[model samples]
Target: MRTRTTLAAAGLLLTLTACGGDTDDKPSAPPSLTEEQRASARAAAGLPPEPSTTARYRFLEALNDIDRRIVDGKDGKDDKAVSRGLNQCRSIKNAAGDEDKQVALVQQTLSRFTIDTRLPDIATPETGGEILAAVHKNLCPDF
Candidate 1:
């Protein structure tokens, strides 16, 4: 469970850079996971990787960075971060399946991000538990 939670947090950091938006001179290459690492990730998430788990991991790292920026109160970073995170999040959601169980998994993950990071309240959520609850409420009210 702990491993899965950590992977979920990492997944949030998965970013647009993995989506071919790098501005560097050299094109970025996807990372290859070792058998142990891949098995750990699979066991953690209890789901096999899509065709692009490397991209997902990179995206999670990026999201983690953006989340730090948000915590630091960087100007105009929230919008960009949230937009990008939401995009990856939607991909995650779609991959997980559009069902109540899937929504619960996402809810677990959002809570894990806050708990694992010890993030201070910054928005209408007002508290970590509330943040998770509100995200669960707003993101998938039907569930």
Candidate 2:
């Protein structure tokens, strides 16, 4: 009788443990883009290399730089960094061909720029919208 009771309790405990544990059945998310991949994409697209340092490719580069900085956790104490970057990005509305390609690259980079671990939970949505608005203004200023 004692042996049977011990076996039944052990079986019940095993069943409970199995039911409470997580399953390995779900698929994991894809890996994120590497710095080299991002740089290559920007270079192949003829966009500015650092985005933030130069004013010749002003608009697009600024956007790319700002996005890169924010995503790379380099956004410093300057609040105007975002606005300044956006302003530069907004300045290239009339560019054509390679210039336009760079602008498009900026737009693409911004579109893919994710704030996942860098931003505060409450500020993420608003910041993203602001970035999107900046991109929109650059792409289509009149709207």
Candidate 3:
């Protein structure tokens, strides 16, 4: 009986560890992008020339900052910031009539992250490409 109890307790402990406890929290590392990768991604996407080196860095900084915030559970702030940034990007594409390539590139990049669509009032990218396509459609339907 004691042996059976010990085995059962061990099994329970293993199950709990595998199940990740009652909380859904999982640890994750911060998101980052290298300068070369950023430049390559922008070039592949046919982005407009950077206003300046500072401007280019600012754009990437903003993206990483928001990504970290989202991962840290700052959902409301993240949503608002991402929405604004995406809208601005869309506006630029619309004005330049260069939406398609940008959308495709963004879709490719966004695929690196896990999208959560179950949240309230959120229309997350099912794939990185989908979000980019949607943004293009919304901002520059002509493209």
Q: Write the per-residue lDDT of candidate 2 for residues 116-139, one digit (tens) a residue.
A: 444435235455545555554443
Q: Write the per-residue lDDT of candidate 1 for residues 1-143, one digit (tens) a residue.
A: 99999998787667534665646768569999898898688546533333244443444344444345333446765444343333334435454555665545444444545433544443222333343333333332232
Candidate 2 whole-model C-alpha lDDT, 0 to 1: 0.49
* Alpha carbon deviation, residue 91, candidate 2 (Å): 21
Model 3 lowest lDDT segment of ten: 114-123
Give the 10-residue window scoring lowest on summed lDDT in candidate 1.
Answer: 134-143
Cand. 1 TM to true fold: 0.28
Q: Sort by lDDT, best first.
A: 2, 3, 1
Global lDDT of each candidate:
0.45, 0.49, 0.48
lDDT per residue as tens, model 3, 17-63: 89875576777887787887776775566443233445433443544
Local error of candidate 3 at 77, Å?
Answer: 4.6
List the candidates' TM-scores in order. Answer: 0.28, 0.25, 0.25
Q: Stretches of candidate 1 above 4 Å error? A: 1-57, 69-98, 115-117, 120-143
Clashing pairs in 2: 59-88
Measured by lDDT, the strongest candidate is 2
